[model samples]
Target chain A: GESVGLHLPTLSVQEGDNSIINCAYSNSASDYFIWYKQESGKGPQFIIDIRSNMDKRQGQRVTVLLNKTVKHLSLQIAATQPGDSAVYFCAENGLKGGADGLTFGKGTHLIIQP
Target chain B: DAGITQSPRYKITETGRQVTLMCHQTWSHSYMFWYRQDLGHGLRLIYYSAAADITDKGEVPDGYVVSRSKTENFPLTLESATRSQTSVYFCASSSGGNNEQFFGPGTRLTVL
Candidate 1:
């Protein structure tokens, strides 16, 4: 009965501006969360991940923020570029002593304007 | 040089026909998953195999079946394809539970 959902379906940002995508989850038991980027024809690619113990994690040009109290997660991209345009997905992992499987969200389409 | 791969990148079949989508992983991961992506519905898990001969149904397992005869292969079959079955199928594998999954190029199926 756990689900991950995005706050927005589409986002548009200027080429040089920053972008923030938000996600909300309903499973408090989920301790692991991952962000994936999927291009038009390719499969989802791992972007960054964060565990419950930590509130934030940073990658090359992206940062993931987690708020356990509010059951919310977000991905931030600095200096957005045209190549960063893609569909972003948030997935949750709550094995709970069982085989770990991911529950994916509906995805947010990011459009970077050049 | 080893990763996940899916066969029949594109497929078109008539209703009531039987079709199978093949998935192979060279990582020899213990966990493999099958998912279908549709507009507005996102990616929904169909089935997953934790190991050889151990398979379990996922959120949208109806009208679909899966088998894991080996640790590196997990195939999904549609016994009787229907119009609603038209969607992009993706195969993913992870080294273990809760690990990052590596996905294959997906198979697009269109059932008429």
Candidate 2:
């Protein structure tokens, strides 16, 4: 059984500060990872993604770092804003032959202290 | 627009009753998934379909059933709802293996 887990269940940060969310996966065969953001009442939106071959990938103001050796993945948000506050989830896609579905981690609630 | 949508944004049903949640995608993605989000459990996959008429159970598929009659539609039905089954349900679709999945606005199910 493959499992994706997060280090923290909740994260509180002040506006204008940087936010970092960490995730650890148990499946070493996972080659693809994605970071998703979900608002209070909305669906999960794709933030960024990285392949096992690459260690890092950047989006508008977000960066995803993957440490395959340690089976760790992290999402970094620069200049965090109030709108960036949401539950962030990390998912792993390691199913061989496309039989396995994405495994999501317990999300980290990002609360912004304005 | 290319996106995924879930019907009946909110649902309230009684225990032992059957309830169905509808999921539709416009991208014609090959992969569709159903997940339930709980307070501490996060998002657990209930079922997924690789293509039309092909489906499989996921981590928590005990009380759920899914059918993929069409590529754009994947619906999940709870044959006998229970109090423990009350949770937010989400439907998502992806283009291919290990690709980014687009999610729909979740349907909040309350089993009374």
Candidate 3:
């Protein structure tokens, strides 16, 4: 079974528009969640993370929102740009520092339009 | 390099052959993990090690093997390559399972 999965396979947005990518996780015990961005020919790069204790965490132009009640997480990107075009993935780990590696979502491809 | 690196950015092998992919990190992180990515599927964990000689199986560990004899090196081997094994392999490390993982460039392997 898939522990995490994205709501959309691909998203196209115009430049300067705010973009939102959604993910659903089934692990009720999951405490830590992270979003990663991967460019062509590269591995996933860390974007932002949120713990179960918080509902939202904001980074530079990026915000992660966690809804434990619904078991959903979302990444909001402000002012989409060409450079922001990439695949976004959400990962979850129940133990903060345990050996249980993260389970990743299939991913959403974000395409920025001029 | 000061971060994690995977050797042979690309590889092609035949069925029933043995192949090993190498991973090395200079950060001396306490955790190392191997993941495989294929089209339409998320990266799946194959194996991981907390420290030297302390390895564990991940979500998709079948047909693959890993060893962590040293803190900085974790190698993944395929005992018998199959066409289904073709995918991009990534190696990642973190101070612990809780922290953010730093991933390598990845190795694209094709089993014929």
Q: Per-candidate DockQ versus the true complex?
A: 0.66, 0.72, 0.76
lDDT of 2 by residue, B32-77 (tens): 9998999888888899999999998888999899999999999999
**How do the residues A1-114 of candidate 1 rate in per-residue lDDT, one tens digit apiece?**
668999999999999899999999999888889999999999999999998899999999999999999999999999999999999999998545225478889999999988
Task: Report the lDDT tens digits of candidate 2 across residue range A1-114.
Answer: 768999999999999999999999989888889999999899999999999899999999999999998999999999999999999999998567345578889999999999
Q: Taking the tens digit of each residue's C-alpha lDDT, what string does model 3 give over B1-112?
A: 6699999899999999999999999999999999999987789889999999999998889999999999999999999999999999999999987878899999999999
lDDT of 1 by residue, B15-86 (tens): 999999999999889999998999989998898888999998888999999999999899999999999999
Sort the predicted structures by lDDT, highest score first. 3, 1, 2
Off by over 4 Å in 2: none
RMSD (Å) per prediction: 1.2, 1.3, 1.4
Candidate 2 chain A minimal-lDDT segment of 10 residues: A93-102
Name the regions of candidate 1 deviating beyond 4 angstroms: A94-100
Candidate 2 pairs with clashing backbones:
none
Question: In model 3, how large is the Cα lDDT of residue A2?
Answer: 40
